[model samples]
Target: MMDKMMATLLESLHEATQRLEQAVAVKESNPDDWLAILDEREELIHQMQERFSAGSVLTEAQRVQLTQIYEVNQRLIPLIEGCKQGVQQQLNNLHRSKLAMNSYNEAGPNGYGAFFDRKK
Candidate 1:
């Protein structure tokens, strides 16, 4: 039973990594697709984390496998974070531009428009 649980946990981690890679690669092309990938990966990670927290004893080989997974994750996490930051920055810039345009389009005063500086 322990071996089975370990196998499932390792499998989950591996699959999550692969899916995360795909999401990162195509993030700009179709962000909606990446969102779906994120949902699936989150479920897998949750299951894997539960298994890991159960205090199961891992053999040397299993420990080695887990270590490899950890190393890969260490490298991938920062890259993913950077990608997320870039996407957020783009969204922020877009929102700022939209607000600026809206403000500029607002009537100057009393519907007189920007051409007239004084109502008289």
Candidate 2:
């Protein structure tokens, strides 16, 4: 019974990771979807931890599955980081553009009066 429960949790974790991988593959995937998958995986990990703490032993097959999951996670790190950098770059560009627009607005016709004295 414990073994079956562990197996089911591991399978769910595996599927979650695969879904995350697919989400990452898309250039325009939503970060929320990635977060959702990570949340599901976290829950599975917690459940598995509880089972292990309750004295469940891992079968060889379960160990292999865990190893594969770890590898997939390792591969995902760089891709996720790349996505993060891309998002950060976009934000930076947006901030710069906003600043430019603000400067332009401030320098319009209203700003020129400040450079000259009305008494002159």
Candidate 3:
């Protein structure tokens, strides 16, 4: 039974890492992917909680590996949050840049050459 539990945890760990990698991959492409990663992270935590409740019967190796995962995730969640913030900031900056360029065009030059001439 303990071995089974350990196996489950190991499997969960593997799946969680894969999910994390996927999240990172799609992070720049879509916000939905990041949200999915958050969900997966929660699921992984819940699995750990369930296993912990079942018993402290984990093998030394399992325990060590689990502890490492826990620590790594403790750092990783913050990094993910930072990534999300960065994506948001980049989107906002792009929007603002577009708006500024539009306003500049409306005010005078409608073309890049015209704007460059005005700048000189």
Taking every candidate in turn, the Cα RMSD to the unseen true structure, in Å, is 4.3, 4.7, 5.1
lDDT order of candidates, top first: 2, 1, 3
Q: Which structure among the candidates has the greatest lDDT?
A: 2
> Residues 8-87, candidate 1, lDDT per residue (tens digit)?
76767677667667666664656566567668767866776776688666677777877876786687678777877888
- lDDT tens digits, residue span 1-120, model 3: 466765776767766766675566564556676567668767866777776786746777777877777676676677778787897999999999999887666675445454443543
Ranking by TM-score: 2, 1, 3
TM-score: the better of candidates 2 and 3: 2
Q: TM-score of each candidate? A: 0.65, 0.86, 0.54
Residue 102's lDDT in candidate 3: 78
Candidate 2: list runs displaced more than 4 Å. Answer: 110-120
Give candidate 2's TM-score.
Answer: 0.86
Native-to-model Cα distance after best TM-score fit, residue 75 in candidate 3, in Å: 5.7
Stretches of candidate 3 exceeding 4 Å from the true structure? 1-3, 22-29, 74-79, 94-120
lDDT of 2 at 17: 92
Cα displacement (angstroms), candidate 1, residue 112, comes to 16
